[model samples]
Target: MKTDTRPILSALPEILKDRCGAFICCASYEERSRCISGAVKDLPFERVVIFAIADIFSGIEDRALEIKSNFSNKTNSEIVLTKTHEPLFTANVVAKSLRRIMDDGINDIFIDITTFTHELLLILLRQINRFKDRLAKVTCLYTSARSYSIGDPDDRKWLSKGCKEIRSVVGFPGLLVPGRPTCLIVLVGFEHERATRTIVEMDPELLLIGKGIPSVEHLTDESHKAPMEFFHNLVQTMVSSRGSVEPFEFSCREPYQTARTILELVTKKPDFNHIIAPLNTKISTVAVALAAMANQKIQVCYAEPETYNFNGYSEPGDKVSIFDLDWDREL
Candidate 1:
């Protein structure tokens, strides 16, 4: 990780100028289409591809039209609708779309995984690794909310309806061999209730990784403390504690390193069941996704929030961390 943080205005010129990018997002009842469209409108891309779930196309019709309208006058934009439930199928569709763009002679690419599910991220990362040599540079983008709402009690729907609670990440084909040490590697984030559910449900050897005490500048001190403490308490609540929770510095953050660490620590043990829940930074989520791609026995799970604080979760903060990965070198 480098100190590449900048405001969206400062960052967009460099990232989106003359670059062919794809925005893989989920459309819901909320303002998700607006969120996706709003960001892409600012970018000066040669071509932009929007990948969304079929349900999103049908369910969020008006916003979808608006998104298309937003980009119609600017760049040559296209929307690819896919079956969001099937990870492998979705990956195949996205891969073909990206390859078609490459066939059109656009090499340098950026992927906005901000609205993607953990499974979607995993498969897409795997697809990117496959086509690494066809591109000059690859950059992954994510939008982090300033504050996440636990949600109002009256809300009954999820913001990301396209996501799956649990899925078998591709590259992991079969069940784990018997008598293996099953481990659950969790990247701790804000949700205590979700984290607790994961701990209770999986019951694997717990391996926790989270941000350091004094986290990054963007996160409020109170907001940061809550998640860290929640992780600690969740671990303590476990009757058979696996071990200690680990912390990583914001500046030294390495998604690939984090993924590689998980492989070195658990997968290499042989005959293991790796269940990863990435509730941390998008970069860290990428790390976990990479790890899931490395082996066939691993499973990735996500517990989507019932409701989002759409109003409170402000965006495009002072800093934007750009996580770069050279697939050939890293993988």
Candidate 2:
């Protein structure tokens, strides 16, 4: 049998030769390493940037140093270590830093959010939006490495909502790509099929609507209605709450189309208070961008199976489950 490694190898050179930069934000050294390794193996870019959240780096400095040494021979890579203990790397700071990096002419940026808070990821996405036009291709990789406590179900749900908001914004042009498995796909309750018809008729927003677990999976088909229904229901829910809602549709299979849809949405709707997203590694970056675009306070709640407090806080010792929510609502 003939083997086909050509596609993989071909993509590598393009990714490597392309102007690429990456950011890895997490609370654990092991998580950071995994992100770094995954990035290196996937992209063939000549330049790579790795940023680590401070809390996870404190105890793993020695290990980090070792990892850095291992890659010392690679001339096109650089690592940025930030201390989460300090207030310096705030969302605005992260945004500015990313702008600087992109201004320096590095395209194809990647961010890994395996161990960071949903808030931090939002900050990064906001920064990416600042330079969407100037930057090349930006990709975010979300890995489910951290476990949330059982006591914070509300928190998890909030986080999931925040992630959806980020997707709304990042899915815009010159922003990050969506439909990747890492992107979050929040399933609002299934409603009547008329929900999809309403979305088609209104055509209020530029959205990538489809059916399937991952947006990417339904990208190839142009007739999927789940996304449209989701959007329609979301609009109805928002309007019912006295909030204005807009919709935009795009081809999730094509990066440019996805980006264009996002850009259009941003241009058309400037009064939306918040963008709700799911809490998954794949879609956190999108949440980040929405928070920035709205310039409003971003809030998240996780939806893990862990028990939550009456006030929606999670205890430290609870066992986190899947179904975590990633969302951002306007404050």
Candidate 3:
């Protein structure tokens, strides 16, 4: 069945006035930092919260200090440094931090999960939902990069050298109730070979693709027509006999739709156990996290890249758009 999809005006806009603060994930790429800084300048946010892995916080803070005056001294601003690759630990720490923010009476927030790890992103989304009532507004912001890493031949080889079936941070034993039939939903992105290996090993009874929409149209030779298109073609050939491939398109920037897509699938097929692997946009990763938060029965998994070629990943474009995505307003 065909699905309904809409693109937010592709034209980027300046920051809206209502936002009081921004919560952004720090990234290795300068573009991600530039996007957040540009928006904060226009909104002139009073509170700025930056989340970064401990290893990356130095670079993150250096970039923030360039645009935000007295960044470390601002009473309303703080930086959250987290351990790398430990999602559960990130969840426990971030949950408490966000709760404290709620208790402290910061009600309106703008969130940018552009560079967060999948596990960390998911946990943060749950906290947003957990404190939705106390929070007056929540705007999810993302600055789309001009291009993405296809990885160097050497980097690709290292990433695909071996595949393991280790349980993910959200999927360790006793994490969720068992005994239900499982369905795997993989969000297809640029890493084709690794995804192929994962699909074969997992051998999902049902396979669905959360098709990712690129923030920009130009793609390098290594790039697929769309991240999902590449997956669709690959899955069709690989899983033709195993199961039918389902594709759903979602904007890379408006991640709430990704959350809706996951929720819709779970609701439509409540009997099946859901495992979501987001190998695409951090925005979509946030969506996957949102869904997992709503239902603990759902599992969120991350493919551990042996080493990411941070220098090779596409930098963010000069443009950034800010929108008021008050999803709770409808409720």
Candidate 4:
């Protein structure tokens, strides 16, 4: 059966119309094509400029050319495909190329680079800002297929710290750095305990299993029975006490299924306030593009992690203690 991807494509029109620029980055050629197809279906292709990288370029060129050749092509959107043999290694060069493209009177651009790393994204982001006058709005997309858990102590510390640092530097509002390891964040109100419980219970345990750790042999079976039971119980407890919760999961790899799943949930529950995502390079560029296209109040949070500090120029003092946590009367 074909995958039901309507949820992801639903809010795209609003996002495209509201923003002056859009960028989509994916991990693979196939995903790039799929994302492009879905994105173009709703966006105003007449003013759009798509920049495809490497193997993805080859696949999209055929479609782009065919579209250009067709008489019914009512839009003036242009698709430029380029090859990058060593993408991550040459991010600075790629950023310069992108800057040149943006300078060519094209305000809206979509970039697809799922093969690169978070550091490369940082480089690109830095460069994009260099030509901010030419670019009114910029959107970065990221994609990954796995799901991560926030339960890991080490992972939480890294993400929380990273988010704080990025916010201190960038100052973009609505900065949501979810604590979950998976990139998907679920916003459930205090009242939807039953539904939340059921959804969590149905989640696959294998989805939560991380790398290096031994895979649970019975994950599939156990997940089928009640994969997110522990999660649901925890949520139920939190809700019963009148506390609200926002839970997210970050996957380690590309083409994150968790993102797709969360998009589906949002479609069914449009009443939810908003979805906040961290503007980290680790996320798939395609996913970022997809999120940008959504109609909800989009907020970008920037964080420059202390781990990236060099020359002893780290942010002075401990920023972690600033968070609203009670250490004196601890549990």
Clashes of each: 1, 66, 0, 33
What's the residue-level lDDT of 39 in candidate 4?
46
Which is superior by TM-score, 1 or 4?
1
Candidate 4 residue-wise lDDT, 243-269, digit = tens: 234334432122234345445544554
Q: How many clashing residue pairs, candidate 2? A: 66
lDDT of 1: 0.56
Better of 2 and 3 by TM-score: 3
Q: What stretches of model 1 exceed 4 Å from their correct place?
A: 1-4, 18-44, 54-59, 72-75, 150-165, 172-175, 205-214, 217-222, 235-254, 267-271, 294-299, 302-318
* True-structure RMSD for candidate 1: 4.9
* Candidate 1 residue 127 C-alpha distance from true site, Å: 1.6
Cα lDDT of model 2 by residue, 213-248, tens digit: 335332222222343344445545543432223333
- lDDT against the true structure, per candidate, is 0.56, 0.37, 0.58, 0.34
Residue pairs in steric clash, candidate 3?
Answer: none
TM-score of each: 0.74, 0.43, 0.74, 0.34
State which candidate, 1 or 4, has the greater lDDT.
1
Error of 4 at 81 (Å): 4.2
lDDT of 4 at 98: 68
The 10-residue segment of model 1 with minimum total lDDT is 154-163
Candidate scoring better on lDDT of 1 and 3? 3
